[model samples]
Target: MKRDVTITNPVLQGVFPDPSWMWHNNEAWLVTSSFGQVPGLPIHTSRDLSHWQRRCSAIDEEMARRLFLKYIRTDNHGIFAPTIREFGDAIIIVSTVMEVMVDKALADGADPDEINRLRAANGNFALVSRDDGLTWEGPHWIKGAVGNDPDFFIDADGTTWWTASRPSSSPRWPFQSDIWMRKLDTERWRLEGPERIIWHGAVEGATWAESPHIFLKDGTYYLLAAEAGTERRHAQSVARSDSLNACYYENNSRNPILTHRTLGEGFPVQNVGHSDMLRDDNGDWWGVCLGSRVVEGYSFMGREPFVFPIVWEDGWPVFTPGDALLRRRIIRGQENTRHGYQLGDIASQEGKNETDRDRHIEQINPNDYLMLPTQPQWIWTRVDDFDYEVLFNPTLMHEARIQQNRDVFASITTDSDSSSVVACISNKGTVQEIGRTALHHDEWYSVRLVGRSVRFAQVPAPNCIPNTEHPLLVGKGAAAVESVAAGGWPVINGGLDIPDSSFAYADAAFLSTESAGGYIGCLAGVR
Candidate 1:
């Protein structure tokens, strides 16, 4: 038999957290939480679990409008983790609307009881789709599920069951909770039977027993959950019982079935947990979870989706057997599988700045731009910088081109009378002003730097739709300079002293690791 080789970890990348997966018609469909980000609850489809593509957003415009009108604002307040399921011909998604007060409010003496009361008003709601997730209807309130991270389990007898992490009646700590379950009367949209506490984590002092997903395997009911919160100590634990209503559950002998908590700061991947499990077409068990990619203990990409294999031993699920730390790579049935879109591919197609040299580019487009949630490639100077919001709206397009051992060009348009400078900064605290533009409200402009010459131009808006147009110049530069150094440090009062234009000659060496002096490389954008 020919073996199939596949890499099965990190099935999806970049800020896709709290993953929930369901296998349907030989295809795997996955959904993740989109906290405070409109077009929320992103859905992805995969065939072999290694390669995936975003299909459509479950939270539609009408849903977003309703949420905005009811919740007041979006920012850690909208949708939490979502559980996706296919029952007969209907697809159901259960997600929590988190409207709790911010931590700053609590620190500033906000009453916990009042915060809880406001949060209680926000509960789990279900959206049903009859056409294989193309269209959805009815966010019917699941009144019984009082907390976040709600998941659904349809029993073998065709009875619908609901399980969620219910907040503790009395205060202990944030996310100190227990798993609860109750049978649902789908017609009435209410709990049919008595609600019961399922499991309160295997570890004695585990604070959060959340993201509970129940699965039935070989006549056993298994409950898998994430514990120790979503930080460095995040982990996956499993418990098995003979019956759904079993008064007690037996914790897996090899508890914390999956985790990277012990990997320390050296590992590139950390905070591994908040998982959901599924069996593939090959009958091999696999898991999808969230983990962060960190560089020297700093992670800006947020939690991402990763997949791992599960092996059963002694009637228990064992994750990545004999290894406590999750590896960056894993081998599956070898069909010669490749996963994820390469940076080169995304740059070539989405960037519109194609060149022969190895270059990575980020273009500002309406589809990919949002006000509340920051884009992935952007690294802001401060948390409160809302400049991109003003620029991205009204469908203004911008492009940044970074060619290795070459020059960097950035083109931006603004609808505000704000003056901003885009520059190339080195790791050794050196700043080279690439382009500067005086952007008036509702104007289009281009900034270019080649060799030692720098020019700024007010151009016509490119006659192209967002995400489809190539970077093209519309007009000539009004101000041209033979030597950029004559600009006198370009916004010297703003920050970083460049002194002279000699720095532009050394553009090739600007972003090198030796010059940057860090585990990560250099960054270029609006500052």
Candidate 2:
């Protein structure tokens, strides 16, 4: 008897979100929301655009420098969902952005009441880069609202159009979304296109419409929108328009074409449809979407990118439902290797830290993973996608040492700093500050762990950060296990269920304030 194995599609894995794509000349250029992770748009350029190989990130430190003062505030904008296009000789993309800072209300007004109220809002907006998207101009004003999971389309007649979800638009209208529209203008930096209310939940509860894209095929303008919220499951709905000027109505079915139950077999993804569709050289349809990885059977991170294949049926689109639990190989043996990447072993250790350009560390996850600056892009917290004002750099971090517990190691690391500094907090939340040390460059660095003993030195590339503390040449030493367990951090509930025991795994990242003014990357190497 011959046995057969079913294969899944997204050959590559991670928490990918808000899929966006562009077909340039003969190459397929695409962008995705990297989320709190540094580096905007995990752009993969493909000759075929089907089988993709990561090339370079569209947004990075250097690019940030060229455009930092132009679009949105650097510290607060962790490049949200962006839209890209080819204008004349160059390619461009704009980001819906938010930056953090002390409340303007506080500065402008004498009233403490009004000032405190304004501080709580996380402002969302649109930013554009005229210099081929490498350097942007401004997040200007596209109306103040929670505009995310946005995208744009170029009309054949040369008019540029836009779409995004006003996720909170339903508070008053029940099932309504501000499917915004605008024209692309070169003379002016921001969207000069006259904006309008293209669509609202005219059908069912468009409760949360996301990633709305407009495409033309066979003289029909097909508008595909992801309906339902991000968790549970997401479905795509389609609407058609005979003219760009005419109002496009929702497809009567008004339901999701795909569901988590269909895609998430046993362990399929919960929600799956803030998608951007792209066509490969071969003409096959593909989409990039946002979903969570749900480690430990619980949702932790906000949303990530999910790539899948798309099929068209009589003017509508369809996607393959995934399994609840992920199957090892999305596609087996077909994983042809170009440049191989390795995720090495990690361990919990108490160590001294040092960094310089030459002294760098690797991330435990895929080396390609990068951390953004602490001011904005790399927002972190006890909250998801937190703003910049509240998110500070962790040039220094604190932690108390408990029993040599296998389950409590956190993967942590800093950007490739010419010099690095980090420390620990004791059981009493007492802070220990480690001064600046030269960072190792070229390859990623890591902590050398041997049980309670820890040393930080330059390892090759690709690894996570260590969380234990090491005393300076002279000072208070690491506390006892009982002291650590008492109050440092509540006894981590599942402190014994990690998949790896041999090597301690680390992923907690807190950046340093030193990299604030200049152009330095605060990268995260996720395993």
Candidate 3:
């Protein structure tokens, strides 16, 4: 037996939500939702539970184009929660491509006639990987497997059952849901047999009962689910039954086995739920779930994946150990420490220089980049700063072009299509362009942007497009654009030092996940 080691809560960081865990060949494999990010469905492998390395995305370029290209128009609109499991020699994944109805339409009192017409592309599907998730095949639409967070339960007798969250036929309230199950025909890739509604939720009037997983212990079937709407009241609960297809009774004594809602607002961690349980080689119970780290009433990194220890007591699972709530740190038996990977903490750590080995940086080249098999570094967001480090004061430099005066281009910009090449800043969901400029089109030019101002220059090139005359460099009125960054938002400053108020100036915090308001943080990628 190995001793327990105290490890950080989120083993995988930066917007990795709804993690599905499985142990294969002594290695831990996990997958998370990408939610419309190209080359979606990221797969991560870890030998030591503490350190995880991204292997690849399950949905490749071909799959993305064929399945999600046209459908994925907005953030959090693509891949929902996914469940990965080992069946025989192959590994299988069951998930939903959530093109579900948007809430805004309902709020605006859109015609009900267009509701189903708009939700035609929403459903559950499965993918298989014979070579250990390196590659995948067939979305093999699981017809009739409706709803979100589809999970697989492989019985001892080789029966594979599928369960998912769906709107209850007998709805007691709006957004009320139920967990249902049916036999999955792996060969035919569809659901067969009578559908059984297993559990509603632990709370009396809980809404959005989702992310259900089943476990068989002794002769009792345990059904674990996430309920309470996945917001401030998000929580995990369990139910049990004697027969596989029988009615499951909620663990009335200890229904919500895990949650941090009781901790109130501004706790270190909040929105904890959507857990998946797995037994280790040492025969100990462990679980993985999604949680958001709150800072000043905002979550910038979105919901990240967290791993914790669980214990079985009186036929129900207990989360953490001494404390029944989510913890910033927890202890777990250390096993399989072969893979030595650690996430760098440049943003939090002190005394780390630009060239310091502790500094974390990633650079992406767009020309050679392929949308399929997207490298783990490529994530969805407004701007992702990889190797480009902007600790307190930052500077951004890049080459850009504008086809027309109506089209604006500079070293960096919130929107390249905006008419003016000006200094701009966004605060509280409002964009203000401070500086304005005009430049020649179909030409190559160098651009540099700092916290207070921006600079541009026209450089002649041979093989590249024609050249043009651009406005000279200058500075801004404010000596330095003061900035405060929480999480990974870069604080850029110091391109060409000149006093000019025309360039855009902004506080780096204005570009944080708090301001963006979505499931993903700011991502640095060429689009």
Best by TM-score: 3
Model 2 scores worst on lDDT over the 10 consecutive residues at 482-491
Candidate 1 lDDT tens digits, 89-126: 88899887765334545675655664443344355778
> Rank order by lDDT, top first?
3, 1, 2
Top lDDT hit: 3
Structural similarity to truth (TM-score) of each candidate: 0.67, 0.57, 0.71
Off by over 4 Å in 3: 1-6, 100-122, 334-411, 414-421, 425-430, 434-518
Q: Count the backbone clashes (under 3 Å) in each candidate.
A: 5, 76, 15
- The local distance difference test score of each candidate is 0.57, 0.42, 0.59
Off by over 4 Å in 1: 1-5, 69-74, 100-121, 170-175, 335-357, 362-527
Query: In candidate 1, how many Å is residue 7 off?
Result: 2.6
Residue 334 C-alpha lDDT in model 3:
39
Worst 10 residues of 3 by lDDT: 401-410
What digit string (tens of lDDT, one per residue) describes model 2 on residues 1-527?
11122222232343344667767767666676643344556666655323677655665655443223123444334456666666556665655444533344245443454223322223333344445444554333333234665555678887765566774543565645667666644343235545565665435456666667788877778766776665564656667778764555546363455545353422323555666676655455666666543322333233545555565666666554332222212321222322111111111111111011132222122244344453332212211211101101233232112101112222224435445423221212233333234433333333322212222333332233332121111011121221111101111112123232222222221121111211111222112
